[model samples]
Target: MEVSKKNKLNKIVKEIETCQACNLCKNRIKSVVSRGNENAKIILIGEAPGKLENEIGKPFVGKSGQQLNDLLSKVGFNPEQDIYFCNVVKCRPVRNNKDRKPNKQEIEACVKYLNAQIEIVKPEIIILCGNTAKKIFKINKPLKMVHGSCIDYKGIKLIPVYHPRASIIDEVKFNDLKKVKKLRG
Candidate 1:
Protein backbone atom coordinates (compact mmCIF):
# COMPACT_ATOMS: atom_id res chain seq x y z
CA MET A 1 0.00 0.00 0.00
CA GLU A 2 1.03 3.59 -0.50
CA VAL A 3 2.15 5.52 2.52
CA SER A 4 0.70 8.83 3.72
CA LYS A 5 2.10 12.17 2.48
CA LYS A 6 4.34 12.80 5.47
CA ASN A 7 5.57 9.23 5.44
CA LYS A 8 6.22 9.04 1.71
CA LEU A 9 7.56 12.38 0.49
CA ASN A 10 11.13 11.49 1.25
CA LYS A 11 10.62 7.93 0.07
CA ILE A 12 9.05 9.02 -3.19
CA VAL A 13 11.80 11.54 -3.78
CA LYS A 14 14.39 8.88 -3.22
CA GLU A 15 12.63 6.41 -5.50
CA ILE A 16 12.33 8.88 -8.34
CA GLU A 17 15.91 9.97 -7.95
CA THR A 18 16.98 6.45 -8.87
CA CYS A 19 14.20 5.59 -11.33
CA GLN A 20 15.10 3.97 -14.63
CA ALA A 21 11.83 2.56 -15.82
CA CYS A 22 12.29 3.59 -19.45
CA ASN A 23 14.98 4.30 -22.04
CA LEU A 24 14.91 7.98 -21.28
CA CYS A 25 16.54 7.25 -17.96
CA LYS A 26 19.63 5.98 -19.79
CA ASN A 27 20.23 9.45 -21.19
CA ARG A 28 19.25 11.63 -18.25
CA ILE A 29 21.71 12.95 -15.74
CA LYS A 30 19.04 12.83 -13.07
CA SER A 31 15.35 12.15 -12.73
CA VAL A 32 13.52 15.08 -11.20
CA VAL A 33 10.50 14.32 -9.10
CA SER A 34 8.08 16.99 -7.96
CA ARG A 35 9.44 19.76 -5.77
CA GLY A 36 7.66 22.09 -3.33
CA ASN A 37 6.13 22.25 0.08
CA GLU A 38 4.72 18.98 1.40
CA ASN A 39 1.30 20.55 1.72
CA ALA A 40 1.02 22.70 -1.39
CA LYS A 41 -2.49 23.74 -2.41
CA ILE A 42 -1.75 24.05 -6.14
CA ILE A 43 0.09 21.63 -8.38
CA LEU A 44 1.53 22.59 -11.75
CA ILE A 45 2.21 19.78 -14.17
CA GLY A 46 4.13 20.24 -17.38
CA GLU A 47 5.18 17.92 -20.20
CA ALA A 48 8.73 16.84 -19.47
CA PRO A 49 12.25 18.06 -18.94
CA GLY A 50 13.83 20.23 -21.60
CA LYS A 51 17.52 20.68 -22.37
CA LEU A 52 18.24 22.97 -19.45
CA GLU A 53 16.07 21.01 -17.08
CA ASN A 54 17.83 17.78 -18.06
CA GLU A 55 21.22 19.39 -17.53
CA ILE A 56 20.18 20.90 -14.20
CA GLY A 57 18.07 18.04 -12.86
CA LYS A 58 15.27 20.52 -12.26
CA PRO A 59 11.92 21.06 -13.88
CA PHE A 60 10.74 24.35 -15.38
CA VAL A 61 14.05 26.10 -14.90
CA GLY A 62 14.59 27.35 -18.42
CA LYS A 63 13.39 30.29 -20.48
CA SER A 64 9.92 28.85 -20.48
CA GLY A 65 10.15 28.65 -16.73
CA GLN A 66 10.83 32.37 -16.60
CA GLN A 67 7.64 33.06 -18.53
CA LEU A 68 5.74 30.73 -16.24
CA ASN A 69 7.17 32.52 -13.25
CA ASP A 70 6.08 35.89 -14.58
CA LEU A 71 2.57 34.66 -15.17
CA LEU A 72 2.42 33.01 -11.75
CA SER A 73 3.54 36.27 -10.19
CA LYS A 74 0.79 38.09 -12.03
CA VAL A 75 -1.70 35.76 -10.41
CA GLY A 76 -0.08 36.04 -6.98
CA PHE A 77 1.22 32.49 -6.97
CA ASN A 78 4.64 31.89 -5.46
CA PRO A 79 6.14 28.66 -6.74
CA GLU A 80 8.46 28.21 -3.79
CA GLN A 81 5.79 28.86 -1.20
CA ASP A 82 2.37 28.13 -2.68
CA ILE A 83 2.74 25.55 -5.44
CA TYR A 84 4.33 22.24 -6.30
CA PHE A 85 5.76 21.72 -9.76
CA CYS A 86 6.40 18.52 -11.65
CA ASN A 87 6.22 16.92 -15.05
CA VAL A 88 4.34 14.12 -16.85
CA VAL A 89 7.64 12.26 -17.04
CA LYS A 90 10.58 12.66 -14.68
CA CYS A 91 13.26 12.01 -17.31
CA ARG A 92 14.09 13.79 -20.50
CA PRO A 93 12.61 12.13 -23.59
CA VAL A 94 14.83 12.76 -26.56
CA ARG A 95 14.27 12.06 -30.27
CA ASN A 96 16.30 12.47 -33.47
CA ASN A 97 19.23 12.53 -31.08
CA LYS A 98 18.32 16.17 -30.51
CA ASP A 99 14.63 17.07 -30.08
CA ARG A 100 12.32 15.40 -27.57
CA LYS A 101 8.80 14.37 -26.82
CA PRO A 102 7.67 12.05 -24.09
CA ASN A 103 6.88 8.71 -25.74
CA LYS A 104 3.91 6.60 -24.74
CA GLN A 105 6.05 4.11 -22.88
CA GLU A 106 7.95 6.76 -20.96
CA ILE A 107 4.73 8.53 -20.06
CA GLU A 108 3.17 5.28 -18.91
CA ALA A 109 6.26 4.53 -16.87
CA CYS A 110 6.08 7.88 -15.14
CA VAL A 111 2.34 7.92 -14.47
CA LYS A 112 2.83 6.05 -11.23
CA TYR A 113 5.27 8.69 -10.06
CA LEU A 114 2.85 11.47 -10.99
CA ASN A 115 0.03 9.72 -9.19
CA ALA A 116 2.23 9.28 -6.17
CA GLN A 117 3.07 12.97 -6.13
CA ILE A 118 -0.58 13.89 -6.26
CA GLU A 119 -1.38 11.53 -3.46
CA ILE A 120 1.28 13.18 -1.35
CA VAL A 121 0.47 16.81 -2.05
CA LYS A 122 -3.33 16.44 -2.33
CA PRO A 123 -3.51 19.80 -4.05
CA GLU A 124 -6.85 21.57 -4.24
CA ILE A 125 -6.19 22.66 -7.81
CA ILE A 126 -4.08 21.28 -10.64
CA ILE A 127 -2.80 23.43 -13.47
CA LEU A 128 -2.11 21.49 -16.62
CA CYS A 129 0.55 23.26 -18.67
CA GLY A 130 -0.33 21.42 -21.86
CA ASN A 131 -2.13 18.39 -23.26
CA THR A 132 0.21 15.89 -21.65
CA ALA A 133 -0.26 17.48 -18.26
CA LYS A 134 -4.06 17.38 -18.74
CA LYS A 135 -4.02 13.66 -19.54
CA ILE A 136 -3.04 12.71 -15.99
CA PHE A 137 -6.38 13.99 -14.81
CA LYS A 138 -7.96 11.27 -17.00
CA ILE A 139 -10.54 13.67 -18.32
CA ASN A 140 -12.06 13.09 -21.74
CA LYS A 141 -11.94 16.50 -23.33
CA PRO A 142 -10.13 18.17 -26.21
CA LEU A 143 -7.40 20.24 -24.59
CA LYS A 144 -7.15 22.67 -27.49
CA MET A 145 -10.84 23.53 -27.44
CA VAL A 146 -11.00 23.81 -23.68
CA HIS A 147 -7.52 25.07 -22.95
CA GLY A 148 -8.42 28.03 -20.79
CA SER A 149 -11.43 26.53 -19.01
CA CYS A 150 -11.59 24.85 -15.64
CA ILE A 151 -13.06 21.43 -14.88
CA ASP A 152 -13.70 19.70 -11.60
CA TYR A 153 -12.80 16.07 -11.35
CA LYS A 154 -13.27 13.79 -8.36
CA GLY A 155 -13.18 16.87 -6.08
CA ILE A 156 -10.07 18.57 -7.49
CA LYS A 157 -10.24 21.27 -10.12
CA LEU A 158 -8.00 21.35 -13.20
CA ILE A 159 -7.17 24.23 -15.49
CA PRO A 160 -5.45 23.52 -18.79
CA VAL A 161 -3.09 26.23 -20.02
CA TYR A 162 -0.84 26.47 -23.07
CA HIS A 163 2.69 25.23 -22.72
CA PRO A 164 5.22 28.03 -22.34
CA ARG A 165 7.12 26.59 -25.28
CA ALA A 166 4.21 27.61 -27.46
CA SER A 167 5.07 31.20 -26.71
CA ILE A 168 8.67 30.61 -27.68
CA ILE A 169 7.78 29.78 -31.27
CA ASP A 170 4.95 32.00 -32.35
CA GLU A 171 2.76 34.93 -31.49
CA VAL A 172 0.87 32.74 -29.08
CA LYS A 173 2.23 34.68 -26.12
CA PHE A 174 -1.00 36.70 -25.97
CA ASN A 175 -3.11 33.57 -26.06
CA ASP A 176 -1.01 31.90 -23.39
CA LEU A 177 -1.30 34.96 -21.16
CA LYS A 178 -5.04 34.92 -21.57
CA LYS A 179 -5.22 31.26 -20.65
CA VAL A 180 -3.13 31.86 -17.55
CA LYS A 181 -5.47 34.65 -16.48
CA LYS A 182 -8.48 32.45 -17.01
CA LEU A 183 -6.88 29.68 -15.03
CA ARG A 184 -6.14 32.00 -12.14
CA GLY A 185 -9.71 33.22 -11.98
Candidate 2:
Protein backbone atom coordinates (compact mmCIF):
# COMPACT_ATOMS: atom_id res chain seq x y z
CA MET A 1 0.00 0.00 0.00
CA GLU A 2 2.79 2.39 0.85
CA VAL A 3 4.52 1.66 -2.42
CA SER A 4 1.32 2.27 -4.32
CA LYS A 5 0.79 5.54 -2.49
CA LYS A 6 4.32 6.73 -3.23
CA ASN A 7 4.03 5.71 -6.86
CA LYS A 8 0.79 7.62 -7.28
CA LEU A 9 2.18 10.67 -5.47
CA ASN A 10 5.32 10.65 -7.60
CA LYS A 11 3.23 10.58 -10.75
CA ILE A 12 1.31 13.59 -9.53
CA VAL A 13 4.56 15.34 -8.63
CA LYS A 14 5.86 14.85 -12.14
CA GLU A 15 2.68 16.35 -13.56
CA ILE A 16 2.92 19.33 -11.21
CA GLU A 17 6.52 19.96 -12.25
CA THR A 18 5.53 20.63 -15.84
CA CYS A 19 2.25 22.40 -15.14
CA GLN A 20 1.82 25.70 -16.98
CA ALA A 21 -1.89 26.03 -16.47
CA CYS A 22 -1.49 29.57 -15.12
CA ASN A 23 0.93 32.52 -15.07
CA LEU A 24 2.18 31.53 -11.64
CA CYS A 25 4.16 28.73 -13.22
CA LYS A 26 6.26 31.08 -15.32
CA ASN A 27 8.25 32.53 -12.37
CA ARG A 28 8.48 29.56 -10.08
CA ILE A 29 11.81 28.23 -8.89
CA LYS A 30 10.25 24.81 -8.48
CA SER A 31 6.77 23.39 -8.11
CA VAL A 32 6.49 22.78 -4.38
CA VAL A 33 5.02 19.26 -4.37
CA SER A 34 4.48 18.22 -0.76
CA ARG A 35 6.23 17.40 2.51
CA GLY A 36 5.62 14.70 5.14
CA ASN A 37 4.52 11.09 5.02
CA GLU A 38 2.77 10.06 1.82
CA ASN A 39 0.92 7.47 3.85
CA ALA A 40 -0.08 9.91 6.58
CA LYS A 41 -3.56 9.85 7.94
CA ILE A 42 -3.95 13.63 7.92
CA ILE A 43 -3.69 15.99 5.00
CA LEU A 44 -2.85 19.61 5.79
CA ILE A 45 -3.84 21.96 2.99
CA GLY A 46 -2.38 25.44 3.08
CA GLU A 47 -2.88 28.44 0.78
CA ALA A 48 0.15 28.20 -1.50
CA PRO A 49 3.88 27.95 -1.46
CA GLY A 50 5.76 30.90 0.04
CA LYS A 51 9.18 32.31 -0.93
CA LEU A 52 11.12 29.93 1.29
CA GLU A 53 8.99 26.97 0.29
CA ASN A 54 9.57 27.73 -3.39
CA GLU A 55 13.30 28.15 -2.88
CA ILE A 56 13.58 24.96 -0.83
CA GLY A 57 11.30 22.99 -3.15
CA LYS A 58 9.03 21.86 -0.37
CA PRO A 59 5.58 22.77 0.80
CA PHE A 60 4.90 24.26 4.26
CA VAL A 61 8.33 24.96 5.69
CA GLY A 62 10.26 27.87 7.27
CA LYS A 63 8.90 29.92 10.18
CA SER A 64 5.23 29.08 9.76
CA GLY A 65 6.16 25.47 9.33
CA GLN A 66 8.16 25.67 12.52
CA GLN A 67 5.16 27.06 14.34
CA LEU A 68 3.06 24.22 13.00
CA ASN A 69 5.67 21.72 14.07
CA ASP A 70 5.75 23.02 17.62
CA LEU A 71 1.97 23.07 17.82
CA LEU A 72 1.64 19.54 16.57
CA SER A 73 4.29 18.29 18.97
CA LYS A 74 2.54 20.00 21.83
CA VAL A 75 -0.65 18.19 20.95
CA GLY A 76 1.17 14.82 20.86
CA PHE A 77 1.16 14.52 17.09
CA ASN A 78 4.32 13.55 15.23
CA PRO A 79 4.72 15.92 12.32
CA GLU A 80 6.47 13.32 10.18
CA GLN A 81 4.34 10.23 10.63
CA ASP A 82 0.93 11.74 11.25
CA ILE A 83 0.48 14.44 8.64
CA TYR A 84 1.08 15.20 4.99
CA PHE A 85 1.40 18.82 3.84
CA CYS A 86 0.49 20.37 0.53
CA ASN A 87 -1.04 23.60 -0.74
CA VAL A 88 -4.05 24.80 -2.67
CA VAL A 89 -1.71 25.76 -5.48
CA LYS A 90 1.59 23.99 -6.17
CA CYS A 91 3.47 27.07 -7.38
CA ARG A 92 4.25 30.23 -5.54
CA PRO A 93 2.19 33.24 -6.57
CA VAL A 94 4.61 36.14 -6.56
CA ARG A 95 4.52 39.78 -7.58
CA ASN A 96 7.39 42.20 -6.97
CA ASN A 97 9.16 39.30 -5.11
CA LYS A 98 6.35 39.34 -2.56
CA ASP A 99 4.27 36.24 -2.01
CA ARG A 100 0.54 36.61 -2.44
CA LYS A 101 -2.56 34.51 -2.12
CA PRO A 102 -3.40 32.46 -5.20
CA ASN A 103 -5.84 34.33 -7.40
CA LYS A 104 -8.94 32.67 -8.82
CA GLN A 105 -7.39 31.64 -12.11
CA GLU A 106 -4.27 30.30 -10.44
CA ILE A 107 -6.29 28.35 -7.93
CA GLU A 108 -8.54 26.95 -10.62
CA ALA A 109 -5.58 25.81 -12.70
CA CYS A 110 -4.10 23.92 -9.76
CA VAL A 111 -7.30 22.47 -8.41
CA LYS A 112 -6.80 19.18 -10.23
CA TYR A 113 -3.36 18.68 -8.72
CA LEU A 114 -4.62 19.44 -5.24
CA ASN A 115 -7.55 17.10 -5.71
CA ALA A 116 -5.19 14.41 -6.94
CA GLN A 117 -3.06 14.77 -3.82
CA ILE A 118 -6.08 14.40 -1.58
CA GLU A 119 -7.30 11.39 -3.51
CA ILE A 120 -3.92 9.71 -3.42
CA VAL A 121 -3.23 10.39 0.24
CA LYS A 122 -6.74 9.39 1.27
CA PRO A 123 -6.34 10.90 4.73
CA GLU A 124 -8.80 10.40 7.52
CA ILE A 125 -8.81 14.11 8.36
CA ILE A 126 -8.35 17.21 6.22
CA ILE A 127 -7.09 20.25 8.09
CA LEU A 128 -7.96 23.41 6.22
CA CYS A 129 -5.33 25.98 7.07
CA GLY A 130 -6.33 29.63 6.60
CA ASN A 131 -8.66 31.33 4.12
CA THR A 132 -7.63 29.34 1.08
CA ALA A 133 -9.21 26.09 2.20
CA LYS A 134 -12.11 28.00 3.72
CA LYS A 135 -12.72 29.59 0.33
CA ILE A 136 -12.11 26.36 -1.56
CA PHE A 137 -14.52 24.50 0.70
CA LYS A 138 -17.00 27.41 0.60
CA ILE A 139 -17.07 27.96 4.32
CA ASN A 140 -18.54 31.46 4.50
CA LYS A 141 -17.68 32.10 8.12
CA PRO A 142 -14.44 33.85 8.88
CA LEU A 143 -11.47 31.93 10.34
CA LYS A 144 -12.13 33.44 13.74
CA MET A 145 -15.51 31.79 13.84
CA VAL A 146 -14.70 28.60 12.01
CA HIS A 147 -11.13 27.81 13.07
CA GLY A 148 -10.98 24.50 14.95
CA SER A 149 -14.49 23.35 14.27
CA CYS A 150 -14.77 19.85 12.78
CA ILE A 151 -17.31 19.76 10.03
CA ASP A 152 -18.53 16.87 7.90
CA TYR A 153 -17.32 17.47 4.35
CA LYS A 154 -18.03 14.70 1.85
CA GLY A 155 -18.32 12.40 4.88
CA ILE A 156 -14.75 13.20 5.91
CA LYS A 157 -13.76 15.10 9.02
CA LEU A 158 -12.72 18.61 7.97
CA ILE A 159 -11.22 21.04 10.44
CA PRO A 160 -10.52 24.67 9.57
CA VAL A 161 -7.64 26.18 11.53
CA TYR A 162 -5.56 29.33 11.34
CA HIS A 163 -2.42 28.94 9.29
CA PRO A 164 0.31 29.13 11.90
CA ARG A 165 2.47 32.20 11.27
CA ALA A 166 2.82 33.59 14.72
CA SER A 167 5.69 32.52 16.95
CA ILE A 168 3.54 32.00 20.00
CA ILE A 169 0.75 29.50 20.30
CA ASP A 170 -2.36 31.16 21.66
CA GLU A 171 -5.07 29.60 23.76
CA VAL A 172 -7.52 28.95 20.95
CA LYS A 173 -5.12 27.39 18.46
CA PHE A 174 -3.51 25.25 21.14
CA ASN A 175 -6.94 24.19 22.31
CA ASP A 176 -8.07 23.59 18.76
CA LEU A 177 -5.14 21.32 18.07
CA LYS A 178 -5.97 19.38 21.18
CA LYS A 179 -9.47 18.89 19.83
CA VAL A 180 -8.12 17.85 16.45
CA LYS A 181 -5.91 15.28 18.18
CA LYS A 182 -8.97 13.63 19.59
CA LEU A 183 -10.31 13.19 16.10
CA ARG A 184 -7.46 10.79 15.42
CA GLY A 185 -8.35 8.67 18.46
Candidate 3:
Protein backbone atom coordinates (compact mmCIF):
# COMPACT_ATOMS: atom_id res chain seq x y z
CA MET A 1 0.00 0.00 0.00
CA GLU A 2 2.76 2.40 0.91
CA VAL A 3 4.62 1.66 -2.30
CA SER A 4 1.54 2.33 -4.43
CA LYS A 5 0.88 5.51 -2.51
CA LYS A 6 4.48 6.60 -2.98
CA ASN A 7 4.31 5.78 -6.71
CA LYS A 8 1.10 7.75 -7.16
CA LEU A 9 2.59 10.68 -5.27
CA ASN A 10 5.71 10.51 -7.43
CA LYS A 11 3.52 10.83 -10.54
CA ILE A 12 1.87 13.89 -9.00
CA VAL A 13 5.29 15.33 -8.21
CA LYS A 14 6.32 14.94 -11.84
CA GLU A 15 3.09 16.52 -12.98
CA ILE A 16 3.64 19.47 -10.65
CA GLU A 17 7.21 19.85 -11.83
CA THR A 18 6.07 20.52 -15.38
CA CYS A 19 2.88 22.44 -14.67
CA GLN A 20 2.42 25.56 -16.81
CA ALA A 21 -1.23 26.16 -16.19
CA CYS A 22 -0.77 29.57 -14.59
CA ASN A 23 1.27 32.75 -15.04
CA LEU A 24 3.40 31.70 -12.07
CA CYS A 25 5.08 29.25 -14.40
CA LYS A 26 6.86 32.16 -16.08
CA ASN A 27 8.67 33.46 -12.97
CA ARG A 28 9.03 30.44 -10.74
CA ILE A 29 12.49 29.04 -10.24
CA LYS A 30 10.95 25.69 -9.41
CA SER A 31 7.48 24.33 -8.73
CA VAL A 32 7.09 23.41 -5.06
CA VAL A 33 5.40 20.01 -5.02
CA SER A 34 5.35 18.59 -1.48
CA ARG A 35 7.52 17.24 1.34
CA GLY A 36 7.52 14.83 4.30
CA ASN A 37 5.97 11.38 4.50
CA GLU A 38 3.66 10.30 1.69
CA ASN A 39 2.15 7.64 3.91
CA ALA A 40 1.23 10.13 6.61
CA LYS A 41 -2.38 10.31 7.66
CA ILE A 42 -2.05 14.05 8.24
CA ILE A 43 -1.77 16.76 5.61
CA LEU A 44 -0.54 20.27 6.38
CA ILE A 45 -1.53 22.81 3.74
CA GLY A 46 -0.04 26.27 3.50
CA GLU A 47 -0.87 29.15 1.14
CA ALA A 48 2.05 28.95 -1.27
CA PRO A 49 5.77 28.63 -1.53
CA GLY A 50 8.09 31.28 -0.11
CA LYS A 51 11.44 32.33 -1.55
CA LEU A 52 13.35 29.39 -0.06
CA GLU A 53 10.67 26.94 -1.09
CA ASN A 54 10.64 28.33 -4.64
CA GLU A 55 14.39 27.91 -4.80
CA ILE A 56 14.46 24.47 -3.21
CA GLY A 57 11.23 23.11 -4.72
CA LYS A 58 9.68 21.88 -1.47
CA PRO A 59 6.91 23.29 0.65
CA PHE A 60 7.43 24.34 4.29
CA VAL A 61 11.22 24.52 4.37
CA GLY A 62 11.80 28.13 5.33
CA LYS A 63 12.09 29.76 8.73
CA SER A 64 8.34 29.48 9.00
CA GLY A 65 8.68 25.76 8.40
CA GLN A 66 11.14 25.49 11.24
CA GLN A 67 8.70 27.28 13.50
CA LEU A 68 5.98 24.92 12.37
CA ASN A 69 8.26 22.01 13.07
CA ASP A 70 8.77 23.22 16.62
CA LEU A 71 5.06 23.65 17.10
CA LEU A 72 4.40 20.19 15.77
CA SER A 73 6.99 18.84 18.15
CA LYS A 74 5.37 20.66 21.06
CA VAL A 75 2.07 19.11 20.05
CA GLY A 76 3.71 15.69 20.09
CA PHE A 77 3.92 15.05 16.37
CA ASN A 78 6.93 14.41 14.19
CA PRO A 79 6.79 16.45 10.99
CA GLU A 80 9.01 14.07 9.04
CA GLN A 81 7.07 10.97 9.96
CA ASP A 82 3.50 12.15 10.48
CA ILE A 83 2.71 15.11 8.24
CA TYR A 84 2.44 15.52 4.49
CA PHE A 85 3.32 19.12 3.77
CA CYS A 86 2.05 20.97 0.72
CA ASN A 87 0.67 24.31 -0.42
CA VAL A 88 -2.48 25.52 -2.11
CA VAL A 89 -0.49 27.05 -4.95
CA LYS A 90 2.66 25.16 -5.91
CA CYS A 91 4.68 28.07 -7.30
CA ARG A 92 5.75 30.98 -5.17
CA PRO A 93 3.27 33.82 -5.44
CA VAL A 94 5.15 37.03 -5.94
CA ARG A 95 4.54 40.78 -6.24
CA ASN A 96 7.33 43.34 -6.50
CA ASN A 97 9.74 40.40 -6.21
CA LYS A 98 8.45 39.67 -2.74
CA ASP A 99 6.33 36.80 -1.53
CA ARG A 100 2.64 37.59 -1.82
CA LYS A 101 -0.72 35.92 -1.49
CA PRO A 102 -1.76 33.94 -4.52
CA ASN A 103 -4.52 35.53 -6.55
CA LYS A 104 -7.80 33.79 -7.35
CA GLN A 105 -6.82 32.75 -10.86
CA GLU A 106 -3.62 31.11 -9.69
CA ILE A 107 -5.44 29.24 -6.96
CA GLU A 108 -8.08 28.03 -9.38
CA ALA A 109 -5.50 26.85 -11.89
CA CYS A 110 -3.39 24.93 -9.36
CA VAL A 111 -6.27 23.63 -7.26
CA LYS A 112 -6.42 20.49 -9.37
CA TYR A 113 -2.98 19.50 -8.15
CA LEU A 114 -3.97 20.11 -4.55
CA ASN A 115 -7.13 18.10 -5.07
CA ALA A 116 -5.17 15.27 -6.63
CA GLN A 117 -2.74 15.26 -3.74
CA ILE A 118 -5.58 14.99 -1.28
CA GLU A 119 -7.24 12.21 -3.23
CA ILE A 120 -4.04 10.20 -3.42
CA VAL A 121 -2.98 10.77 0.17
CA LYS A 122 -6.47 10.38 1.61
CA PRO A 123 -5.29 11.81 4.89
CA GLU A 124 -7.41 11.49 7.99
CA ILE A 125 -6.66 15.09 9.04
CA ILE A 126 -5.91 18.25 7.11
CA ILE A 127 -4.42 21.26 8.85
CA LEU A 128 -5.05 24.44 6.86
CA CYS A 129 -2.22 26.72 7.94
CA GLY A 130 -3.61 30.15 7.10
CA ASN A 131 -6.51 31.93 5.47
CA THR A 132 -5.60 31.16 1.87
CA ALA A 133 -5.37 27.49 2.66
CA LYS A 134 -8.65 27.57 4.58
CA LYS A 135 -10.56 29.56 1.99
CA ILE A 136 -9.91 26.94 -0.64
CA PHE A 137 -12.17 24.66 1.38
CA LYS A 138 -15.05 27.18 0.88
CA ILE A 139 -15.08 28.33 4.50
CA ASN A 140 -15.02 32.09 3.98
CA LYS A 141 -14.18 33.28 7.46
CA PRO A 142 -11.25 34.75 9.31
CA LEU A 143 -8.75 32.29 10.76
CA LYS A 144 -9.20 33.90 14.18
CA MET A 145 -12.85 32.99 14.16
CA VAL A 146 -12.54 29.54 12.65
CA HIS A 147 -9.16 28.33 13.85
CA GLY A 148 -9.02 24.97 15.64
CA SER A 149 -12.49 23.73 14.88
CA CYS A 150 -12.57 20.48 12.94
CA ILE A 151 -14.93 20.76 10.02
CA ASP A 152 -15.74 17.60 8.15
CA TYR A 153 -14.17 17.51 4.70
CA LYS A 154 -15.37 14.34 3.00
CA GLY A 155 -14.93 12.38 6.25
CA ILE A 156 -11.57 13.96 6.96
CA LYS A 157 -10.97 16.41 9.81
CA LEU A 158 -10.28 19.86 8.36
CA ILE A 159 -8.63 22.25 10.81
CA PRO A 160 -8.04 25.94 10.21
CA VAL A 161 -5.07 27.49 11.96
CA TYR A 162 -2.88 30.59 11.83
CA HIS A 163 0.10 30.42 9.53
CA PRO A 164 3.41 29.49 11.09
CA ARG A 165 4.72 32.87 9.93
CA ALA A 166 2.04 34.54 12.01
CA SER A 167 3.05 32.69 15.22
CA ILE A 168 -0.46 32.99 16.56
CA ILE A 169 -1.64 29.83 18.23
CA ASP A 170 -4.96 30.38 19.85
CA GLU A 171 -6.47 28.02 22.45
CA VAL A 172 -8.39 26.11 19.84
CA LYS A 173 -5.33 25.58 17.66
CA PHE A 174 -3.25 24.39 20.60
CA ASN A 175 -5.86 21.98 21.88
CA ASP A 176 -6.66 20.66 18.47
CA LEU A 177 -3.04 19.93 17.74
CA LYS A 178 -2.56 18.30 21.09
CA LYS A 179 -5.72 16.25 20.77
CA VAL A 180 -4.73 14.83 17.43
CA LYS A 181 -1.53 13.26 18.75
CA LYS A 182 -3.28 9.99 19.37
CA LEU A 183 -4.71 9.96 15.89
CA ARG A 184 -1.26 10.47 14.38
CA GLY A 185 -0.55 6.82 14.88
Model 2 ranges with Cα > 4 A deviation = 1-3, 166-169
What CA root-mean-square deviation does each model show from the true structure? 3.4, 1.9, 2.1
- Model 1: how far residue 153 lies from native, Å: 1.4
| Model 1 misplacement above 4 A | 1-7, 168-185
Minimal lDDT window, size 10, model 2: 165-174
Q: Please, what are the lDDT tens digits per residue for candidate 1 over residues 34-125?
A: 66666777888999988788888778888988887777776666667777889999888887667477887889988998888887788888
C-alpha lDDT values of all predictions = 0.76, 0.87, 0.86
> Would you give me the overall lDDT of model 3?
0.86
Evaluate model 2: give its TM-score. 0.94
Give residue 104's error in model 1 in angstroms: 1.0
For residue 147, what is the lDDT in candidate 3?
A: 78
Model 2: pairs clashing at backbone N, Cα or C within 3 Å: none
Residues 4-64 of candidate 2: C-alpha lDDT, one tens digit per residue: 9889889998988888899998878888989999888899898998999999989878888
Cα lDDT, model 1, residue 11: 85
lDDT for 175 (candidate 2): 84
lDDT of 1: 0.76
Summarize candidate 3's per-residue lDDT along 104-182 as a digit string, tens digits.
9999999999999999989999998889999999999887788777799889999888887775544555665776675
